[model samples]
Target chain A: MKFLDFFRSKRPSSASIAKERLQIIVSHERRRPSTPDFLPSLQKDILEVVRKYIQINENQIKLSVDRNGDCEVLELNISLSDPGKK
Target chain B: MKFLDFFRSKRPSSASIAKERLQIIVSHERRRPSTPDFLPSLQKDILEVVRKYIQINENQIKLSVDRNGDCEVLELNISLSDPGKK
Candidate 1:
């Protein structure tokens, strides 16, 4: 009986459930805002800078802007393959 | 000669350098603004709710508020332990 109870307890915890709900809500909030007019130019400039030194596909770069209070944050994530391996 | 050049290429690429630079800049930007006044209370309330259902350490939960233009986003991340293991 104890073993059966243990197996049954495999149900997801409340914390996981809360996290899933929060992710959905946060992603929705992130997508609701229209991108700023300058974002495309910004991305293009950054991509050009990166391309000058490395051979990378377009998918390797990501750029996003997030706001905190009145402050704006530009976040860039780039994945680079080792040049030697290439 | 080619092998020697290959070993020398192990030096970090421009993309890696760019990423490191961006991380420093973004982290600085994230820290520049003072946290909002209501954030502590909000975290406490959420912690209380989560604690009601699971045994989790304080560090297991993370909460942050980020803004995008006029929109505000509350990001919550929680790590849950398997109840059966406990």
Candidate 2:
């Protein structure tokens, strides 16, 4: 039992932990997996939904998230399309 | 030696591999660990550097990244302060 417990209870080294944490941060900072292809799909959906009611300046839309410790804020910025165009 | 090699060579379970991948992607997707407090420091630096030449419309500035498969792009948007205000 003592031998089994010793094997089971050995802690991970600090360097490995730090490396793991760094990897997590880099992956998050880089925004993994989600493709840039998503933007056109989103733009199409948004325009389809909003075009009849109001013109949209598709160029100004922004979606982002900022993290501070455990707190996170998601930002959305959208500007109205030029009225003269309509 | 053959038995030792077999024990050493067993590939990690697929579920474990997937979970590790997901953890990496989530940590990356969430933009791990960078504090929002850093923004105030950045704003202060910008204001100090640019105050003599031009007022900055800090509200309009954006820094973001978009990724598509292996490709990644970083975006920076800055709008100058209203000239009339200065």
Candidate 3:
């Protein structure tokens, strides 16, 4: 099979190229449609932990478990208001 | 060029497959490296409009501008608390 491939142009497989693109786009997004039941409780737990760092309310945080290939990424975004503004 | 393609099995181009995958993942996430200057202001503005519908703070809403090929998608997720829970 290696010898036969040489007869064609030496371009890398398109699948690999697509894989790279897929990785970039999916890095922040979560896969699957079903959301777990523990999410509310999980949010509560995170709020408790984050409170030590900054004064934030329940509305200021988002917790998502994103799956990429074999690994899962726990993505947390927290918004802090600027002290200078108000 | 056209005649030579017939000798090969009719597999859809890898580019199209990657494109489909990209669409699925990127539907929710934003693109580009630089966070736009207007985003903070935009979120503030959206918060005002959304306040009319339901009681939510800036934290409960996520606004993203995602680019799919030539078009752009504005994705927003607003978390509404379940009244029955508490």
Best by TM-score: 1
Looking at candidate 2, what TM-score does chain B attain? 0.29
Write candidate 2's Cα lDDT for B1-86 as tens digits.
Answer: 22122222332465432211100010111122331222223333433433333344556455454443222233333332232144
Docking class of 3: incorrect
Q: Across the candidates, what are chain A's individual TM-scores?
A: 0.43, 0.29, 0.37
lDDT of 1: 0.33
lDDT of 2 at A22: 7
Q: Which has the higher TM-score value, candidate number 1 or candidate number 2?
A: 1
DockQ per candidate, 2 decimals: 0.02, 0.04, 0.05
True contacts kept of 3: 0.05
Each model's lDDT comes to: 0.33, 0.29, 0.32
* Residues B1-86, model 3: lDDT tens digits: 22113212222365532211111111111223332323334334434443433355556555566553422333344444321122
Docking verdict class for candidate 1: incorrect
lDDT of 1 by residue, B41-73 (tens): 434554454344345565655556554322234
TM-score of each: 0.26, 0.19, 0.23
Complex DockQ, candidate 1: 0.02
Best by lDDT: 1
